[model samples]
Target: MSAFDCIDTFITGGTAVIELNRPRQLNALNRKMVSEVVEAMESFDRNEEVQVIVLTGKGHSFSAGADIDEMAEDDPIRLELLNQFADWDRLSLIKKPIIGAVKGFVFGGGFELALCCDLLIAASGTEFSFPEVSLGVMPGAGGTQRLTKLAGRTKALQWLWTGERIPAEDALTHGVINQIVSPELLMEETLKFAAKIAKQPPLSLRLIKDSVNKAVDYPLYEGMQYERKNFYLLFASQDQKEGMNAFVEKRKPEYKGR
Candidate 1:
């Protein structure tokens, strides 16, 4: 029996979909939900058949944020305990690519979760914010770090300090989201994009994700070295030979992900 409760997971076309299932609470992230998400991600990362993972929420909202009820009940001791087992940290280390399909309210922890993804596709009218300031707290789940890195200090500071909701267009302009589609076509568009990525060679895809992440976390010189090494490494993969041969033969490459 699976341990996931707040998440609905399934696989299709080499892509795993992990949908937040708590629509009534706007798919709020609580301890259980966060744990489930991490487990699901780890499982998919180990699954050779799954080349991509799509994360979204059921119903109207992607996620409103962390569950306030859960937060309110946590004392300093419990909060400290929770910090010791930071699930978000594990989430950030996932090897496979993750695409976030966001809509409705994406605030606080929800926004942080999206930032953990490799790409984000949002609904046209999706709202994003960091309302933690208003609650006498601040984002504690890599919100400040990731947002600042993605959207520069000025935009990230303004958004975090004000705790005001920004439209999807504004989010995209600030580089917070990759693309936006109409709500009616959100899932269809996201799935289509995921399928396209899933068709790529899995080893190359993983290396690409690793190289990009290294560019963010490592010094420029070290990052360039890492990227160069990966580029050379791909030449040793079977998919590389197949890809080049397919082009010469005027045929499609059938990648075995070896």
Candidate 2:
């Protein structure tokens, strides 16, 4: 991956890691940083060598939130014309699985970003909140919708209204986070988990990810139809044939992402 100003991206063990830089600022999501993340993720999604993507930051905190200074500096009209968040639409369209490795503060837009991941591995002592309401604005990036879906309407409103910090333990209990590890072991465990998923059949992984996500957006019957179609579609892939044949022959299967 090429060098990026706000983030560092690299691929290893079929897992692509996009590490947010700017530790001094707690890796705030400025327009540039958000854009770089989307671009790098798209590239990784298109690369057959990369099967999973992990998004993390290189500071004590994953992200404090969006760059408040940048937002205050920009003219509303200019910002409107620029449509910075258009990249977010593209980010959501990525087909491959995304894993968020979070630590410390995950607030406002940062919390929203973490929720966008298909899976989350958070560090113990992390604090998550939607502080935008306190600032006279609400979450503009699907935070309200996603949080309500994951943590239930009552809990989501309780936090959103108070702008209170949620401990990692509570986040885990509410199903917002998949696992919690010590800060010292955050990246290690995240990469290890990502590697496990990376080793799966790529076509199957992508299809299943898509099918599962459809459950959130589609009606029950529609989601089942989508899932059933993808389940059947796998039979046409060479990896499916190899996987079954290998099982019958008592051999390890080698998937080529076909």
Candidate 3:
């Protein structure tokens, strides 16, 4: 049984789906929701059956942002103790891939949550924003850092400062989202993509994610070194030999995730 009241989780075909369930509040992220997300992610990471995770909302809006009502009452100390944003860091540390399936409103903390995913697939009519500036607060999560890394400083600064809602097309153009599809096709397309990745060798997927993530934090040469190490290490795995031999035999490789 799930301890979460604000979210729903299930696994299908090696892909786990975590849906924000508070439709009444547009799934606004409160402390409880954040905590539940962290706990669910940790559980999924330990579950060998799950190869990928997809995050979405049950209703029209993916999320409206953080719970303003809760934020208004909480003091700095309380907020610090909650460690809401740190949950995102924990999610990122998971070896398996995470895909955000966004639709409708994705604002403020909601935007930060989507950014935490390895890839994002947005509905055509989805709206994304950083509305914290209007709330007289700034994004406490990795919003600033991750947005800047993805879309560059100028665009990130412009969006954060203005608190404007960016449409799916603009968000994709800005490199915030990987793909955009009709609302009805959002889940289908996202799951299809996740399934493709899930079919790959688990160890290779983990190494690929690790190496690419290093590019953001390490210098060019250091990133290359990390990539090189992972590349060499793959040679020792059974999947690598199977992959090569299958190519030679003109057959599909059966990866056991070794």
What's the TM-score of each model vs. the native? 0.96, 0.96, 0.96
lDDT of candidate 2 at residue 210, scale 0 to 100: 91
Q: List the residue pairs that clash in candidate 1.
A: none
Error of 2 at 122 (Å): 0.8
**Candidate 3 residue-wise lDDT at 106:** 98
lDDT of each residue in 109-143, candidate 3, tens digit only: 99998898999999999999999999788998899
lDDT of 2 by residue, 37-128 (tens): 99999999999889999999988888999999888767779878999879888888899999999998999988988988999999999999
Q: Order of all candidates by lDDT, from best down to worst?
A: 1, 2, 3
User: In candidate 1, how many clashes are counted?
Assistant: 0
Off by over 4 Å in 2: 73-77
Measured over all alpha carbons after superposition, the RMSD of each candidate to the real structure, in angstroms, is: 1.4, 1.3, 1.3
Task: Give lDDT: candidate 3, residue 113.
Answer: 88
CA lDDT scores, all candidates in order: 0.93, 0.92, 0.91
Assess the local accuracy of residue 131 in candidate 2 as a C-alpha lDDT between 0 and 100.
Answer: 95
Off by over 4 Å in 3: 1-3
